[model samples]
Structure formats: structure tokens, C-alpha cells
Target: MLTAAIGTWKLVTGRADKLFAGASEERLYTELAPGKNRLIYLWGHLTAVHDRMLPLLGLGPRLHPELDAIFLTAPDKTVAELPSTADLTSAWAGVNAALLAGFDSLTPAQWLERHADVSPEDFAREPHRNRLAILLNRTNHTSFHLGQAVLAPK
Candidate 1:
């Protein structure tokens, strides 16, 4: 189970790394259309989601404030200033490293324990899912948005 969690995190982080690698500085902040979503906004939201969700899996908070700043915006807001590709890329690498470390430290019994903090009512129906499920959800969410960021217009 812990292996699965590590694999999922690696896969999602690799996708995010690829998305940022080919993008230019101009592309980082470019929106698909006027007042639409941009690469930075997508990356920022991913960071915010990670910040909020990863702690439930026993990972530490995000290390970068710029990434955390994305959480300040309401969910309805679309337009946002993007961090430079260099900065975004650096932060992503750091986050990936930290998450990998966390995953490495988890034991099989730890993975199976029901996280006390996550409410099933808050998410779907029940609150008894294991840590691995939460981690998988987060990985999927990050991958989904990373794909959107990659396809976003410059």
C-alpha cells in the first residue's frame, strides 16, 4: 500500500515536471483566453490542493509561500498572476522530494489506519477510508490539473 502511494506521487510529480519543462516564461502565465485559466493558476491550485490534502497523509506543509498564495483565491476566481516557470519548477521539485520522503517513511499498518481528520461527509459519504485512498485522490487531482496546465494556451 505504501509502495502504491509512492508510485502515485512519483507519477503525478513527473507529469507536473514535464508540463513545466517545455513551457517558456511567457507560457507560464498565458491564459487560454482573456479572463480564463492560465498555467500558473493551474500550478498554484495544485500546490494549494497539495498543501491542504497531503497533511492528512502525514506529509508536512508546503515549503513555498508563492505556491501557498494560490490558496488565498476563491475557487471561482480564474485570472491570477503566475509564478515564473523557474520558480514553479523549483517548488514542484521540492514538493515532490518532500512527498517522496513522507511516502518512504510510511509503514503498511500506517497506510491502513483510518485518518481521523478526513471526513467522509466532507468528501462523499463515509469517513472510514484509509490513508492510501486519500493519497490516491490527491495524486489523481494533481495529475488532472497538471494535464490542464500543459494544454493551456500561451
Candidate 2:
């Protein structure tokens, strides 16, 4: 399970890394059409969520708590200011590094354990909702948003 989980993560992150490897700060704000979210928002949102996952899995704290307001939980098109692309990139990379490190510490048992907000009793009742499940859900979400990124005009 560990091997499979890490392998899946590697593939997904690899694809994401390639996609954003050449993304400039200016390009990060490009949208597929008017009123759509900027690429930076999506990227920052991804970073923020990944940061959240760390603590959810009993890993560590969020690298950018400040982003939670703008990236996580905030409704789309909500009027607000955002951080610079470079700052977000730093947070994104740092969170991913810490997440990978945390993954290395988890055994298969840990993967099956309950995640944040979901109590042990609830996790027992909903067997499918575990730490690994959270990762799977987040990974799927990232892939979905990646499609949006691909469609945005370069």
C-alpha cells in the first residue's frame, strides 16, 4: 500500500510539476475566459489544500495559514487580495516536501487510520474514509483542476 500510494503521488506530482515548470507569474493569472479563476488561484489553492492535508494526517501544521482565507474555503469570485505567485510557489514546494516526508513515516496501518475532523468512531463506521482516502480524494481533485489548467490559454 505504501509503495502504491507513493507511486501514485509521484506520478501526479510529476505531471503537475511539468505543467507548471515553465509557468510565469504573469501567466499564472491567465484565465480560459473572462471571470474564470486565475491559474495562480488554482495553484495556490492546491498548495493550501496540500498543506491542510499534512495536519489532517497528523503530519504537521500548514506552511501558509494566511492563504487559507484566499485559497481555501473562500467562494469563487469573492472579492479579496492574493499573494504574489512567487510566494505561493515557495509555500507549495515546502508543503509538498513536508508531505512526502510525512508519507515516509507512515506504515500501512497508519494509512488506514482516521484522518482529521473524522473521528475514530466515524472512520470505523465509514471504513473507506481514512488518511489514504483523503489523499486519493485530494489527488483526484488536483487532477480535475489540472485539466482546467490545460484548457487555459497559454
Candidate 3:
């Protein structure tokens, strides 16, 4: 199950890399629909969320905590001065690289251990709130954004 989950995550993120590579900088700014998030916003949002997974999984500190306010907490276009496409692209790569390394370091038993966010007591009762569960959730979240991002107007 761990192997399958990690493989699925890599497959989805690989598709995301291809999608982002194909999109032009200007096109990334265009919204998927009226009042919807832009492709660039989705990209940054994924990067930000994935960065948070580091600490949550006890992998390491967040590499881009600043992105939380811009991409995680705030709505799209609400915050001005978003990071440049080049910078965000770099961050996306960096975060994923770190996550890959961390994931590789963990044993299957470690993956089953409780993550950082859930309280020990709650986790004791709901043993499903583990690092692997968080990874699965984030993987699904990334896929959802990737689907939406693909619909962004030309």
C-alpha cells in the first residue's frame, strides 16, 4: 500500500510538472473561469501546501513558509506581489525534491506513525491520521488542482 501510494503520488506530480512546463507565463495568469483561481495561483497553492507537508510529516521545516499567506490562506488575486513564475517554479521543484528525499528515508512503519498536526490523544483514538494518510490527502488535493488548472483559458 505504501509503495502504491508513493508511486501514485510520483505519477500525479510528474503530470503536474509536464503541465506547468507546457503553460506559458501569460496563460498561467488567466483564470480557469469567471471568479475562479488562475493557473499560476493553483501552482503556487500546490507548492505552498506541499511545503507544509514537510513539517506535518516530521520531514523538515517548511521551505517556503511565506507562501502560506499568499497562496495557502488568502484567496486568489487578493494578495498582490506574488512570487515570480520563475521563483515559484523553482520552489515547486525544491519542495518536491525535499519531500522525495524525506519519503525515501521513512520506513513503512514510520509512515504509519501519527503526523505532527493531529494531537496524540486524538491520534491514539483515530489511528488513521498518519503520515501516509496526509500524503494520500495531499496527493488527491494536487490532482484536483491539476484538473482545474488544465481548464484554464488559453
Candidate 4:
């Protein structure tokens, strides 16, 4: 489980780095549509997935609770008010590093422990599957959005 988690996190961080490489500050905030900004879209999706997975893994919310209140606003929010593409990329890198560290510290037995509150409808086959499952899903999810974000017009 530890090996799988580390591998998945490395892949995720690599993809995120590739996604933002050479992107200009102007490009980060550019909206493809009116009232539909790129930073907000990407950050919101990332936050939402993290919010879901963190609780399952017994981690605190990714961002502060007060910040979440702000993000709950209609248009969503940028990554911690990052005003430039470079800043945004740096922010993502920080998040990736933290996730990598957290995943690396988990033991195999901890990964397999069942969550008592998991519902039958959850996609995970059992309440106590490998914690790597969450990391894998998050990595895949981020990759999908990063692709979309790249393709989106500035």
C-alpha cells in the first residue's frame, strides 16, 4: 500500500508540474467564459475532491474552514487568492508535496482499516480497502481536470 501510494503521488505531482509549466500569470486567471474563471474552476474541483477524500482518510480539511466558507460563494475561489499563474503553480506544488508526505507516512494496516460510516453505495468495494485507492482516485481526477484546464482557451 505504501509503495502504491508513493508511486501514485509522484505521478500526480509530475502531472501537476507539467500542467503549469511555462504558464504565464495572465493565463492563470483568464476565463474561458464570463463569470467562469479558470483558477476558480480548477481550484474548486481540486478542493471538492480533497474535501471528500480527506474525511475518509481521517485528515483535516485541505484548507481552513473559514476559507471554505469563502469558496462556497457562487463563482468559487482561486487557490488561496493566488494572483498570478506562477503563484498558482507554486501553490499546487505545495499541495502536491503535502499530499505526498501524508501518503508516505501511512502504514499498510492503516490503509486497510474499514471506515465504520462508509455506506454500501460507496464505490469502494469494502469499507476497508487500500488507502491507496483514495490517492489513486485523486491523482486520476486531477489529471483529468488538468487536461481540461490546459485545453481551455485563455
Candidate 5:
């Protein structure tokens, strides 16, 4: 589980770095495609989700709880405006750095432990829903959006 978690994080960061490269702070508000989310929104959403994981993994509180409203769910620019690109970028770096530190501190047994909201009974019933699994799922989620992020230049 530890190996899988580390490997998935590596994959996620690689895709994210490539996507963010050459990204323009000015062009972030532009839609990647015709009707999809703006490039900035995707970056903020991923940052918010990863920040929330801090609490879920018992690392610390979310660095930007304000982002949860617009980021936790699907993209909805009409509902709420996102923060500036610089702010989101800082939060993204801080959250990810903290996550890596926390993950490194966890023993293999802790990786198998249930995450924040899952009760013992529920965890026993659903062994696949452990903290390691959540990391893998979120990594895949980041990669999926990274695919959309690459469309910013088009």
C-alpha cells in the first residue's frame, strides 16, 4: 500500500507539473474548451481537494477552507468566483508539501487505517476504502483533470 501510494503521488505530480508549465496567469480565466471549466478553476479545485486531504489524513486543517465552496463540487463559476492564481498556487504548494510530510511519517499500519469520516464498523466492512486507497483515488482524480489542463493552450 505504501509503494502504491508513493507511486501514484509521483504520477500525479508529474502530470500536474507538465500541465502547469507555460500556464499563463492571465489566461487562467479562459475556458480550456468550449463549455468546460476555466484553467484556473481546475487548478483551484485540485488544490482545494488536496488541502482537504490534510484533515482527512490527520495531518492538519485545510489551508484554504474558503475554497471548499467552489472547489469541492463540480465547476460553477456562476455560483462562486475563485481566488487569484497566485493564491491558489501558494495553497497548492503548501498543501502538497504538508501532505508529503504527513504521508512520510505514517507507518504501513497507519496507511491501512480508516480515514477521517469512516467508522470502524464501516472500515471493517469496506477494506478497500482505507487512507491509502483515498490517496490513490485522489491521485487519479488529479491526473484526470491534468488531462483537461493541457487543453489550456488550445
Candidate 6:
């Protein structure tokens, strides 16, 4: 199950990375909708969310905690200053590379262990809140955003 989950995550994130890699910096500024998140925002948002998963999974500390305020906490276009697409692009690669390494190091038993945020008591009661669950949820999240992101280059 863990293998399958990680494979699916790799598939979706690879699609997202390819889309961003092929996109021109100017092209990423276009919004998915008239007032919805721009492709740039989605890139940073996904990077931020994945970076956080490092710590949540006890893989390691976040490579870019600062991204939370701009991409995670605040909505699109709300923050006056945002990182350059190039920077976020680099960060996206870095975070995912780190996560892949961490994921590779963990055993299937480790994946079934509780994530960092869940209390021992809670984890005992809610075994579903394991590390593998985070990967599944984030995989779906990335796939959802990737579906929207594909509209940008069109």
C-alpha cells in the first residue's frame, strides 16, 4: 500500500513539475480563473505544503518554513510581495527531492506509524492518522491543483 501510495504521489508531482518547468515565467502569472489562484500561486502553495510534510512525517524540518505566510496562510493576490517564479520553482524541486529521499529511507512500518502532529492517545484511537495517510491526502491535493494548473498553458 505504501509503495502504491508513493508511486501515485510521484506521478502527480511529476506532472506538476513538468508543467511548471515548461511554463515561461510570464505565462505563470495568468490566473486559473478570472479571480482564482494564479499558476504561480499554485506552485508556491504546493511547495509550501510539501515542505511542511517533511516535519509532519518526522522526515526532517521544513526547507522553507517562510513560505507558509505567503503561500499557505494568505490567499492568492492577498500578499503584496511574493517570491519569483524561478525561486519557487527551485524550492519546489528542492522540497520534493528532500521528501523523496526521506520517503525512501522509511520502512513500510514507519509509514504506518503516527505522524508528528497526532498525539499518542489520539493516534491510538485513530490509527488512520498515520504517516501514509498524509502522503495520500497530499497526493490528492497535488492532483487537484495540477488539474487546475494545466489550464494555464492553454
The digit string of per-residue lDDT tens for model 4 on 6-53 reads: 676677657656555545555655664566657445654465455555
Give the number of the best model, judged by lDDT. Answer: 3
lDDT for model 5 comes to 0.80
What would the per-residue lDDT of candidate 3 be over residues 18-77, giving only the tens digit for each residue? 887568989988999998888888898999999999999999999999999999899999
Deviating ranges (above 4 Å) for candidate 5: 79-81
lDDT of 6 by residue, 30-49 (tens): 88878888988899899999
Question: Which residue window of length 10 is worst by lDDT in model 3?
Answer: 17-26
Write candidate 1's Cα lDDT for 1-154 as tens digits: 4666677778777777677666776786687567767666677667666665556676765576555545445542533555666776676666666767777787887776666485656535553487777788788888777766756765
Per-model TM against the reference: 0.74, 0.91, 0.97, 0.64, 0.89, 0.96
Ranking by TM-score: 3, 6, 2, 5, 1, 4
lDDT of 1: 0.67
Question: Considering summed lDDT, which 10 consecutive residues are worst modelled in model 2?
Answer: 75-84
Per-residue alpha-carbon lDDT of model 2 for 1-154, expressed as tens digits?
6687678887887777677646876777787567798777788788888888988999987777887888878855684678766676688888889999998998898898888879878877898878899888888878988888888787
As for candidate 1, its clashing pairs are: 120-126
In model 3, where do residues sit more than 4 Å from their true spots?
none
Instruction: Specify the highest-TM-score model's number.
Output: 3
Each model's lDDT comes to 0.67, 0.81, 0.92, 0.57, 0.80, 0.91
Task: Compare candidates 1 and 4 on TM-score and give the better one.
Answer: 1
